[model samples]
Target: MKVIVEGLHSRGHQVSVVRSSDSWYIKETSPFYTSITLDIESGFGENFITTFVAQLLETQREGKSAWTRFKLEMEQAQKASELHENTCKMLEMLFENKEVIQSLHKAKYDLVLTDPAIPGGVILGHYLRLPLVFNVRWTSQGEGHLSIAPSPLSYVPMTGTELSDKMSFLQRLLNVIIFGFTEYQISQYVLPNYVCLIEKYLGPDTDYLSLFQAADLWLMRVDFVFEFPRPTMPNVVYMGGFQCKPAKPLPQHLEEFVQSSGEHGVIIMSLGTLIGELPHDLADEIAAAFAKLPQKVIWRYKGDRPATLGNNTLLVDWMPQSDLLGHPKIKLFVAHGGTNGVQEAIYHGVPILGLPLIFDQRDNLFRIEVRGAGKIIDIFTMNEDTFFQGIQEVLNEPSYKKNMQRLSRLHRDQPMKPLDTALFWIEFVMRHKGAAHLRTESYRLPWYSYHSVDVMLLLVGVVLIILGTFAALIRCLCSIVHADGTFRRKG
Candidate 1:
C-alpha cells in the first residue's frame, strides 16, 4: 500500500489512507497523501489475531499430524468467532463515532482500495458505492477470494501444506479435506459474522458478499517464479517485488560494522513486525549462537536488550532492512520468512536462514528451501548448535548463494518491473471503468459446471440410457424367437 500510494501520489493523484492509530510500524506518509487514523485501543484486536496465529505456529512446532492440526483448527475456529465478535464491537465504536466516519467517507474518492483481510474497508466500499479494488498481500485461495481460474484440488496444495503441484494420492485427498474444511469455516463462521456486523453497523441493505465479488481488480503480491503454475484470471495481476527497490547507501556506522567483518560477511536478523519480543530464554540462546559466529550480527531486538550480546553483535530496535540486504558484505538473512522480507532477500540475492514463526511465513520458508536458496529451522527447535549450524550451512554452501543469485536474475528479468506493472494495471482499470470485461465467466458458474462435473454426469446418464435400451431390445428379440419356435412345433 505504501509503495502503491507513493507511486500514485508521484503521478499527481490524490490518495488517502484510513488506518488504525496503533499500527505496529511507525506512521510514515508523504505530504501529498492524507492519513486518517481510527481512535481506538487497537491492542485487543491485534492481540486476538496474534493469539490465533500463535496457536497455529505452536501446533506446527509440536510436529503434530494433519488430523491433530485439523482438530485444533476446528477448535480455533470457535475462538475466532469470538474474536470476530470483539472486532465487530471495535468497528462498531468507529461507526458510532460519526465524526470519524464522516471524515473517512466525506470526499467522493475515485476508488476504494483495501486489503481483503480488513473488513472495514470492504464495508465502507459497499456503503459508498465506489469502485472497490483488493491489494491482497497473500495467496488468493481462501477467505472467499476464490480465484476465477480453476485450481485443481489434486495438484494445487492447500494454504499451509507446503506441498508442490505434484501430490501423492493421499496428499490430494488430504488437500480436498483441508480445502473443504477451510471453506466450511469461512462460510459457517467468518462470513456470517461479517454480514451481521455490516448489517448492524453499516446499514440493512449493504451486502458485503456482493461487494467482495464486485472487486474490479486483484493485485496479488506474488510472482509466478515463486508460485507453482496455476490458472490465473485476467483481473488478477502479479506484483511480487513491488515493495523491493534499489538499495540506498547505509549509514557510516553500519558500513563500518559490515566492513569490520573482513572476509566474513554480516547477517541481518529480524522477526518481522508481529513478534516484537522473543522469550528471554530464546533470546539468550540466540545471543549465545551469534556470539560464536565470525560474521558480524546486526540483530533487531525489540525486547529488553539481551545481556549476552557479544562484541561482534550489534543490537538495535530497527535497521534499514532492504538497504542492509543489498550490501555486498551481507551473506545471510535470519528472518521470520514474511513475504516482503523473503522477496527483498531474493531481490538482493542474499541466502536465508529462515526461522518461520507464523502465518504465511512457514510456507514462504518452504519455498526458499525447495529452491535451495536457504534452510528452515523451527523456532521452537532452535538451540545454540542448530541455530549456529543453520547459519554456517547457508554461509558456507556456495549452492545457496548461487541459487539465490539465479532467482534474483529471474525476478529482475521481467518485461516490466513490478511497480510499473502494478501502476499499469491500476490505470488500466481506471481508464476502462473497472475493467469488467477482464473478469472470467467462472465466477457466474456453479461449482459442478465450473469443474465440468455436471457435463460428465450428463454423459454418464446418456450412456446408461443407451445401454438400458439395448438390453431391452435384446430381451424382446429372444422372446419373439422362442414364441416363433413354439408356434412351428405346434404346426
Candidate 2:
C-alpha cells in the first residue's frame, strides 16, 4: 500500500492515509500523504501479533496430527475473530463520530483504496459512496481471487491445502474440504461482527462480502509467474514484484563480507518480520546447518545467539532484504516464503531454500517447489542434517537457478512496470469515477445462480417435460392402433 501511495504521490496526486492511533508502522506524519489518525486501536498491535505467531510456532512444533491441526485452526480463527471484533469496535466509533464522517464526505475523495483483509475501509468506502480499489491479495474471507474470480476446486488449491494446480481425486477432495473449512471459518469467526456493524450502519441489504466483490479495481499482489494459471477477472491487475528494484551498492561492511566469500557466493536467511526468533533448539539447528556451508551466511535474527554459532555466519537484527537478494554474490535465499520475499527472489532470479513458518508461507513455497525453483523443509521435522542437505540441493543444482531466472525474465517482459500499471488503473478509476464496466456482476447473483445450478435445474426440467410429453403421445397412439385392429377383426 505504501508503494501505491508513493506512486500516486509521485504522480501529483494528493493522498490522505487513514490509520489507527495505536498503529505501530503507520506514522502520524508523512510527506507523501496526510494522515487521518483515528483515536482507536488498530486491532493488530506488535506484541499481540508477536505473541500469536509464537504460539503458532509452538503448536506447529507439537506435531502434525489431525488434532494438532484442528487446534491450530481453531486458535487462528479465534484470534482472527478477536482482531475483527476490535476492528468493528473501531469502526463503530468512527461511524458514530459525526465530525469524522462529515469530514470524510466533504473531502470528496474519488475512491477508497484499501487492503480488504480487514473490511473496515471497505465499509467506510461504501458509506462515503466512493469508488473502491483494493490493494489486496487476502480479503476478510480468503484470497481475493476466491471471492471475485471463478475458482474451480478441481485445480485451484485453497490456502492451507498447499496443493498445486494439478490434483488427483483425493487432492481435489481435500481442496473442496479445505474450502468448506475456510467458508466455515469466515462464517463462524470472520463475519459475525462485521455483519452486525453492517446491518446497523450500512443497512441490512448491504452484504459485507459484496462490498469486497464490488471494488472497482483490484491491484492484485500476484504475478502468474509465481502464481498458478487460474481464472481471473479483467478488473484485477497483477503487480506482484512492484516493490522490487535494482540493487544499490551494499554497505561497506556487508560488501566486504560478500567479497570475502570469494567464489563460494553468499546465502542469506531471514524468517520475515513476524518470527524474529525461533525456539532455541530450532535456532541451534539452523545455525548448525549454516556452519556446514562454505558460502558466507547473512542471517536476520532477533533471538539469542545460537550455541552452534559459527564464524561463517553474520547475524543482524535487520537486513536490507531486497538489496541483499538483488546482489550478484547472493546464491540462495533462506526464506519464510512471505509474498514479498518470494516475489523479490523471483525478481532477482535467486533460488530459494524455503523455511516456511505460518499462514501462506507453506503454500507460497509449495508453488516455488512445484516450479522447480525451490525446496521446502518442514520446520517442525527439520534438523541440522536435513536443513544443510536442503540448502546444498538448491545451491548445488543448476535447475533451481535456471528456473528462477526464467521467472525473472517473464516477470520483466511486461510492457509497463507493474507499479506503473497499478498506478494507471488507479488513476483510470479516478478518471472514470469507477470501473463498473470492467467489473463482473457475479457478486450480485445468489450462490445457486452464480454456479448456474438454477439454470441446470431449469434445463433438466425442460428436458423432462419434453420427454414426458413424447412418452404419453407414443402410449396413446399404440393404444388407439390396438383398438382399431380389434374393431377391424370383429367386423
Candidate 3:
C-alpha cells in the first residue's frame, strides 16, 4: 500500500490513509499524502503466536500422532478465530466513535483502497457506498471473495494445509475437505461476528459477504510461475513482485563480509517478523549445522546469541535482505517461506532452504519444492544432520540454482512491471467508474449457479427423465409380451 500510495501521489493523485494505531510498521513509511492515524486502543497484538507455538511444542512432545496433531490444530484455529473476532470488535468500537464516523463521512473519498485483512475498509466502503479495491499483499492467505477468484478445491491447497498443487487422490479429497472447512471457518467462525458489527450501524439490509464481494478489483500478490494455475475472475490481477526493487549498494560492513567470503559465498537467513526468535536448543543446532559449512552465514537473530557462533557466521538484528540476496556472493537463502521473502529470492535467482514455521510458510515451501528450486526442513524435527544436509544439497546441487534462475527469468519476463500493472488497474477502476463490466456475472450468482452447478443439475435432471421414460416403456413391452403368451396358452 505504501508503494501504491506513493506511486499514485507521484502521478498527481491525492491519497489519504486511514490507519490503525496498532500498526507499528506504519511509522517506518512516509507517504506523500495525508495519513489519518486512528488512535483507538486496539490492544490486540498477534497474541495467538505464543499459544500457537505452545500448541506446536506440545504436539511435538506428545509423539506427534496424526490425531493429536489434528486436535491441536483445531484448538489453535479456534483460539486464533476468537482472537481475530475480538480484534474486529475493537475495530467496530473504534469505527463507532462519533468523531471517526463524522470525519470519514466528510472526507468523501472517491474509492476505498484497503488491505484484505482489515475489515474496516469494507465497512467504510459500504457505509460510503464507494467502490473498493482489495489489496491482497500475501498470496491467497486471507478470506477472499470466491466469486472473484474461485479456488479449485481439488488442486489449490487450503490456507493452512501443507498440500501442494499436484495431489494424489487421497490428498485431493483432503483438499476438498479442507476447502469445506475453510468455508465453515468463514461462515461459522469469522464472518458472522463481522456481520453483526457492520449491521449494528449499517442496518440489517447490508450483507457483509455482499459488500466484500462487491470489491471492484483485487490486486493479488502472486505470479503464475510461483502459484499453481487455478480458475480466477477477470477482476483479479496478479501483480507479483510489486514490492521488489532494483538492488542497491550494500552497506560497508555487508560489502566487506561478502568480499571476505570469496568464492565459498554467503547464505542469508531470516525467519520473518512473526517468529522473532528460535528456541535456544534449535538455535544451537542451527549454529552447529552452519559451523560445518564453508559458506559464511548472515543470520537475522533477535534473541540472545547461540551457544556456539561459527567463525563464518555474522549475527545481526537485521540485514538488508534484498540487497544481500542481489549480491553475487550470496549463494542461498534460508527463509521461513513467506510469500514476499520467497518472491524476493525468486527475483534474485537464489535457491532456498525453507524452514517453515507456521501459516502459509509450509505451503509456500511446498510450492518451491515442487518447482525443484528449494528444500523444506521441518522445524519440529530439524536435527543438525538434516539442517546441514539441506544446506549441502542446495549448495552442491546445480539443479536448484538452475531452476531458481529459470523461474526468476520467467517471473521478470512480464509485459509490464507488477507495480505498473497494479497502477493501471487502480486507475482503470477510476477511469471507468468502478469497472463493473470486468466483473463476471458469477459474482452476483449463487455458488450453485456460479460454477454451473445448476446447469449440471439440469443436465442430470434431463438424463434422469429420459432414463425413467425408457425404463417404463421397457416394462410395458414386457407386460404385453407376457399377456400375449398367456392368451395363446388359454386358446
Candidate 2 colliding pairs, count: 0
* RMSD versus native structure for model 1: 3.3
Q: Which wins on lDDT, candidate 2 or candidate 3? A: 2
Ranked by TM-score from best down, the candidates are 2, 3, 1
Please list the Cα RMSD from the true structure of every candidate, rounded to 1 decimal place: 3.3, 1.2, 3.3
Clashes of 3: 0
Per-residue lDDT over 133-159 for candidate 2, one digit per residue giving the tens place of the 0 to 100 score = 999999989898988999999989899
Q: Candidate 1 at 375: error in angstroms?
A: 0.2
Report clash pairs, candidate 3.
none
Point out the higher-scoring one by TM-score: 2 or 3: 2
Residue 274 shift from truth in candidate 3, angstroms? 1.9
The Cα local distance difference test for each model comes to: 0.79, 0.92, 0.80
- Per-residue lDDT tens digits for candidate 1, residues 60-162, read 6666577766766776677766755655666778778888768667786778878776466676676666777778863222522354455788877777777
Better of 1 and 3 by TM-score: 3
Which pairs clash in the backbone of model 2? none
Off by over 4 Å in 2: none
